[model samples]
Target: MDGLLLRTNYSDITEFILVGFSRRPHVQAAFFSGLLCLYLVTFLGNSLIVIVIQRDPQLHTPMYFFLSNLSFLDICYSTSWEPYVLTQCFKNFPTISYTRCYALMTTSLFLGMTECLLLAVMAYDRFVAISNPLRYTVIMNNQVCLQMAVGTWVSAFFISIVPIVAIPANFCGHNIINHFTCEIQAMLKLVCSDTSMSLILGLVISTFTLPLPFTFILISYIRIVAAVLRIRSTEARLKAFSTCGSHLTVVTIFYGTAIYMYVKPQSKESQDQDKVISIFYGAVTPMLNPLIYTLRNKDVKGALRKLIGGKEKS
Candidate 1:
């Protein structure tokens, strides 16, 4: 019996308890309701953009192609953890299996990183359109767009896998994750071994994936602005800014929340605040992206109307 107890104690844990949201029943109910709405909206909105982009011949340009990719990424990024978050809001300290936990973490990381690079690519596409309008078609040709899109996905997946595969789930300490989802940082808090390597790895990865991409976007926009300013017509500049404004807003919100969540120093108070900020990054941002793009872009709004009008005519 003593030997059996010792074996159990020494065994690697296979599950983790997710301490999600508030324990108050009222808060849980409100959270569940709000998150469910956001999930449904995100799924519907992003799916609509994907369908519209696929069906609308006018949106076949490289810009729309990248926008479609971003929409799809938002869908995937939200799906990686939102459902689990919804489940956790209703249930107290729900447990997720180690395998599933890591799977969610890996998927979230993959999508997040892919999005960072994809945004940069989109910014580059805009720069090409603005700075070299004469060769925009040649530069952002179908082949180039396809290559960039594939590279973004492949690169992000490999980068995400590096740390995930290196960090084994052989945790020998507390298995309680303080976040709504199986976040890498929250999961790291449970590791009994020295997590310095993992922490350093995360920091290095963040440097490359987060701020680097943001800087690239800023540079691209700067160049684009310079080119736009050279245009003599006031209407032309307004049109140019309007075209890229939605994307810029999205980049700001996404990177702002992500930088705060990952790049900021961790503390007890920040940990508590992390859950709230995470909702913006994980749930609200995805839900808002489709709306931001569709509402701001007349082309998308027209396509949506055409789609709905066609259905009605049928």
Candidate 2:
């Protein structure tokens, strides 16, 4: 049995090649082009958010602070995925070593988890604004917002370390990850050893990382909705709901895709399907965020008008 097991091992299997859909040269070329464009747009959109938020002191509220961080994270998130795939177009086989794999996985997990925390924080900001407009500034002051932001990154930092320490113990088999990036699910599937520990770690982290944050967001919005309903003024309630409505929509898409990817067991039928969902959370979500936020936001539009009007006046 030992000899049989050894027989299956090939010297060339040291690197796990990505079987990214469609080996056809045309399909691959199209994929590379498309991903490159998305990558560029992702950076530009997020960078503009950061720049505009920082430059426009009037927009220096908790909302824009969170938006700037979100944009920065989106930029980093895309970097964690796109650079590897795009490099493949130029190189014969864009290979990542074990050390690189571990690093990439850690970065992706860190940013992904951090975004989970940040989104929850943003939801709370919206919740506070709609529910208690009288005390918005005092409630979401610079010091308070700073703590929230710092706490988010720190939580993700320490939380990510747990997985990094855990993953190295598993005996890597075939060392190939199927997706564009070194995702946790992709890494776990290739391990030769028992996955019980990885699963347990995933469960533990996911509790802090997902459901609780989701629960908080849910509770906040539930209260928010209730408060909005009580307001006899139709115009005020409608205006409040409009802002919260956009946030709710964006949250549902972001969390819905994320929950689909990570919450369920990836059965054989769902594995390829999961890949598409991963693209939704990992790629599509970032691109959509700035568009959704800026276009939907009345303040941002007003600011843009002021910016353009000032330019025209000059």
Candidate 3:
């Protein structure tokens, strides 16, 4: 098995041919058209959220501060792959250079891991707001919010860099990545060397970065639920649920697709399924995020209406 795996020369592997899917022109064309629209919606929608948050003083709370950061991350997250995917749709064989592949992998991982931590932080913010309403402002002030944002980005960047340094160097053979993007799992599959260390490190990282944050979110929600239940007024309960619900939905969509893509055992069928899921998380979710937040949150809706009405009147 070891001999069979060590079958390619790493020195010759300058670029990777991303044989994304079947070569049906119609399929590619359809994919291109659909994904292009989603990309536009994602870019514009998230940009709108950021703009609204910045322009509307009403949205200057800790929640919206975190939300604006999330919007920015969504923009970066989608662009890291959407443009490449769009370009690949027209080509007969989409290829990525070694350096570019590493870049894509790093950027995607950094943004994604950062989101995991950000969502957890947002959940903690909600806990503070709902459970300790009196001191919420003091607890989640500008300094704390800024530190959390900076911490998420810095930690995720360093965590993502581990693979960039190790994987390329250890990819002793094979240059063909069997996906549209240089996803860590797909790239890992192409390595023709002993991947035990890489695999172990990846597993360790995933455990800490994925499950730990998810646990925090889960625990936060549990306490939030307890607090919400204590509220006597129906309207108050609904309002409280609404705030947590939107974040929960977004978190579910993101973490669900991500966990499915990364945590599962790789198989031919699963790999094909993962391509569709990649499109969902990479494009669809980002487009839906702003809609979810704006549609569900009255302040955001009102602010948007105010912003639009003011422009129209002028």
lDDT of every model, 2 decimals? 0.81, 0.72, 0.80
TM-score for candidate 3, residues paired by index: 0.92
Instruction: State the lDDT of candidate 3 residue by residue for 93-135, as single tens digits.
Output: 6788877887787788788888888989999999999999999
TM-score of each: 0.92, 0.87, 0.92
Q: How many clashes in candidate 1?
A: 0
Q: Report the candidate with higher lDDT, 2 versus 3.
A: 3
User: What's the true lDDT of residue 237 in model 1?
Assistant: 90
Worst 10 residues of 1 by lDDT: 1-10
- Assess candidate 1 and give its lDDT: 0.81
- Candidate 1 lDDT tens digits, 24-139: 56688888898999999999999999999999999899999999999899988988888878766778778988678767877787888898889899999999999999999999
lDDT score of residue 82 within candidate 3? 89
What is the model-wide C-alpha lDDT for candidate 3?
0.80
Error of 3 at 35 (Å): 1.1
**Quick one: ranking by lDDT, best first?**
1, 3, 2
